[model samples]
Target: MTEAEMLMEEKLRKKKEEEEEMWAEYLEQRKKQRAKEEEELRKLKERQAKRKLQRAEQESKMNEYKRKQEEQRIREMEEKKSREAEAKRKRLEEAEKKRQAMQAAKEKREQEPVKPNFVISKREGDEMGSALGSSGLDKFANIMYARGEMGKTKEQMEEDKKAILSFRVKPLEIEGLTVEQLRDMAKKLWEKVVALESDKYDLEERQKRQDYDLKELAERQRQINRSRALKKGLDPEALQGKHPPKIQVSSKYERRLDRRSFEDKRELYDGGLEAMTDAEMEKMWEDKMNSFKEQSRGQLPKWDPENPKNKQVSHIRRLEEEDDDEELVPVFEPPKPEPPKPAAPPPKPAQQQEEEEEEEEEEEEEEEEEEEEEEEEEEEEEEEEEEEEEEEE
Candidate 1:
């Protein structure tokens, strides 16, 4: 080998060696970069998986919340339906109870025995007459008199008149009273008139007897005066006084003898039945009945005692029962008389009578003493009993 050729070959070997080192460094760098890129890709894939799991968990929570809400809504609907059903059941039960009670009452009413009704019909002759006029004002006046509320004062009369005019319509006027009330009033008036007439007749008969006695006495006095005049040998006619006393009774004496009372004349018109004959009474009764029927127009319904709606039984019977209860006085029997003692023998003389009386008085005194002793003994016995009771207590 020549020296020049050895130098060129050494230079080429050195260049080749340098090029191989650079290539090896470049490959190492490429390997490191690939590994770093792979690590980055692995980290990114893990983060993506975590996020997907969290999203799935959130979706599950949302679905659970929606399911709970649906269940709650269903439960509330069921509760509301139960409350309405309970209310409806209560209402139905109340209605059924009321219906059953009403049915029971009806059955009881039907099963009870019905009592026969007795109606006391007013007699045609017992009806009120035309004592009052045939006008509305007169009818009200009749009611006032019948009810015993006839006012004495003008103001009171006017007020009562107004009240009667304004009275509400009912089955019958005058506080819904029946026609029998007026009949009863007429009957009372008739009785009062009869009593007053009887008293007057008695007084008149007494006056007639007194007048007869007075005339007999006057005749006896005249006969005695004539006898005295004849014995004196004077004319009986000439013996009279210049002014002979008139045969008249004093007015004060007549008034004192009269027995009629003030109450007898009150409300008495034509003296009622006292002046009427039997035929006249019958005729008047018939007329009065006809008049009452005409006036009333036959609107009064017959009263039944057994009917619950009848006012006569309600008010009149209850009032009578109350009066009876109030006046239930106890009757006490009189004490029985003691048996008579044996009679003593009559005294033969006045001295014997006086001696017997003295003996009787002495015996009475001894009896009184004995009675006093007995009373004292009884009082002591009572006191001893009281003391014994106190000691026992």
Candidate 2:
């Protein structure tokens, strides 16, 4: 072996060992840097987690505060509603009380009687008592008893006995009153009650009397209706209407003519007269006569206005009437009828005269014919008889 080859191999081996040792040292430094990076990452993660937990706690506190505020608002609203309800109830109760009070006052006023302004003096009361008869005095005593100024009646005593028997405690022993005092108090109460009963009885009797009077009045009215129906020529038994027969008074009482115009007034004398009953027309005529008498008191003068001698006086009176604003009515006379025309002679009984004349003519003709026939018959008989005689000779 050459000595240079051995030496170069040894140097190569030494260089390889140095390279391995440097590589191992660099690996150890890398491991240490990785461990430090892991530690810093863990610390940063812990800081982020702590910040998130703090934010969650703050949000929960805000939610809790809002919930409490809402609950308090709801409580205040409920209290306000209750206060309003209580105020309304009180107002309604007060209104009802006022209404009841007014009703009670009205009832009290109606139950009480009217009082006179002046009071009776003691002397006047004594005089009135002295003037009363026995019956009037008894009535006066009843009034006094009702006013609590008199004694008890028999019915009142009976009522007092009943009241005493119904009591739980004896009135004589109550309130440390004596037996005589209790009796007196009971008598006074009984007298008041009896007076009230007497007043009720009087009212009942008065009502019965009023009903009887009403019945009598109704019967009298019925009788009057029957009499009126008879006078009016109407049948009372056949009447079906509630009202009485119509009995119209004359127009004189009604004064219907006072409402008539002059043209309408003329209808009374014309066709309107036919519509009036005989009694009404007669009454109207009587009224007219009375009105005429009243109106003609100083209407006409003694002298006629148409006379020649009274012309000057009439003219002066007319001037005065004109000055007095009065209208003068002119008088009219009825016209005389024309003389009657000469009448023609009355016609004779022509048919009867003609029959009489015809009978006389027939009698004359029969007499003439009888005379001629007899002459003829006599001539013929003589001629025959003469012939026979001749024959016999």
Candidate 3:
């Protein structure tokens, strides 16, 4: 071979060997990079799987929360519905109970017995006939019906009449009541009638007095006005005393007899006294008078039972006495008489009699001696005790 051919071959061999080494190194590097990339991808896939698992768990928890909330809402709704139903039931029950109570009351009223009218002889036969034309008979009938002595309908009247007739009538007997009781009742009735008459008279007198006072006041006012005009240099003949007649209006005047505090009086006054009726005014006056009397009674001095005037009074006399402390004499009580003893039995036989006589004599002697000594000793002890008490005092 030529030297150039040998050198060319050697150079080609060296280039080939270098190319093989480089290819081997590139393959090893490519293998190492592929293993690193596969490892990173695996780690990323594991992270993504973990994230998906977490998201799934979160979604499950959210679903559970929503479900629990829905259940709670449903329970609340049920409870509210139940409460409303219970309230409605209670209201219905209450209404039913009230309705039943009213029905029972109505039934009781319907079943109640009514009084019967006992017809008496008329004062005048034609009195009702005269009243009929004036509508007074109808009013009286209505009053009778209201008193249950009459009925509105014919059927009701018949029923009432039948029911009243069924009861056995007995004669009213006046008994048991004492003469004193009757007299007291009569006296009370008489006093009531007299009081009513007196009250009526007092009212009339008060009205007349008020009218006279008002007239006098008006006259005085006119005179005052006339004097004022004269003083002002107006002609006496031309200037009339009367300007205009004053309109009289009913008014109430309160006199505080108890002297209540200013605040209390103001409170009472502020409540408005303009609308009080005559009766109301009278009642207020009575109440005030009673309060005054009560206060006066409380302030009154206490009575001394040790006083001579009260000495004869009984233990309970203080309770019965009036607030004025008047002297009250007690009623005297007579002493009760002792009952008489029965007569003695007949004397016994001689031996028993002898023994009895001996016993009697002995008892008589002991009694006689006992009486003298007891009397003397009692008197001495009494005197000594009195002296000792006085000395101690």
Candidate 4:
């Protein structure tokens, strides 16, 4: 119970008071936090309930709209059905009327008496009118109408109707015309007819001449083709199917490689070209031709000597031979045309024919003698060449 002990007791008392205040403040803070959390949870529940109500309202509206659409579709179907039924009923009524009218006509025809009819001959003017088509177009128009051969489309029908209505002109009033005027008109018409007939005759003559010339041209062409086929030793039928060779597509090696004879022992630059057998070469050519034809849709240009054109250029093919170093492949060799021979004159009369034969015999003997001289000269040149070769050896 001294002064120092009293000072210590006062410090303890202050410490106890501070601890009590801290506890009270902590309890108040906890209560406020709990209240704030509870309020937030309540607001969240209210929002969720409001959204649910909105969704329900939207669903109700959608269902109502679907119901209205279904009702409209049903109503439209019913209306269309009613309209179709009404149209069908009208068509049946019309058909009945047509049938009744036809039956009445048949009955009236049956009740009427039959009579023999007289035949009438066509007038000369009418026959001429038909031949010259003076009234044929009018009759043709009538026939088209009766046969229903005119255009059935709406636009064409409108055009036809306009033509009928707008072109209904009155006939020429010959009652007011004078005799001299009528005669003059008739004369003019006759002149026009004569001119037309003359023109027609000239055209017919021209056509006949043209046809004859065409036949002659065709005959000449056939003869030329036949002669060409014979000279080339080819079948005329094969010529029809033959076509120009297709464009060649070479590989890089094929382009650069120098094709040489196998026995000639050729020097190479880069990889040398290898030679294939005759069979292999033929097979390859056939395959290439087939592929080209397929790509071109089996359509190829036929060679025409008369109208010659630039052909597709191809690489020169080399072939080995027993005698020669290289033999060129004649893939598309054109036939050399020979000069024409002069035609002999026709045979004369029997008395003159004897004289012509004697002359021909004399010409033959002279030609044979000249040919013998040429053969002797050729044999002498060959002997001289052999002698020179022996001396060189």
- Reference-based lDDT, each prediction: 0.72, 0.73, 0.72, 0.69
Residue-level lDDT tens digits of model 4 in 102-167: 657876987889866475556664664564434767678667765763447887567555544343
Model 1 misplaced stretches (Cα beyond 4 Å): 1-22, 109-393
Alpha-carbon shift of residue 379 in model 3 (angstroms): 99
Question: Candidate 1 residues 150-178, lDDT tens each?
Answer: 43578756754554434321233446557
lDDT of 2 by residue, 251-308 (tens): 4446444765666666556755455677698999999999999999865534444444
Candidate 4 lDDT (Cα, whole model)?
Answer: 0.69
TM-score of candidate 1 to 2 decimals: 0.24
True-vs-predicted CA distance for residue 188, candidate 4, Å: 71
The residue-by-residue lDDT of candidate 3 on 1-393, one tens digit each, is: 999999999999999999999999999999999999999999999999999999999999999999999999999999998898577556446655665696578669779897665755455666656633435776776577468643357876675455343432334344898889888877977986796698699989999999999999988876877787688655453345345433222222435344555566556645445545766989999999999999889555456554333553754575566533544655577988988988998968899989998999999999999989977876786677557756766
Please name the candidate that would achieve the greatest TM-score relative to the true structure: 3
Q: What is the C-alpha RMSD of each candidate to the true structure, in Å?
A: 55.3, 53.5, 47.6, 43.4
Better of 3 and 4 by TM-score: 3
Models 1 onward score TM values of: 0.24, 0.23, 0.28, 0.26
Model 2 local distance difference test score: 0.73
Residue 203 CA displacement from its true place in model 1, Å: 84
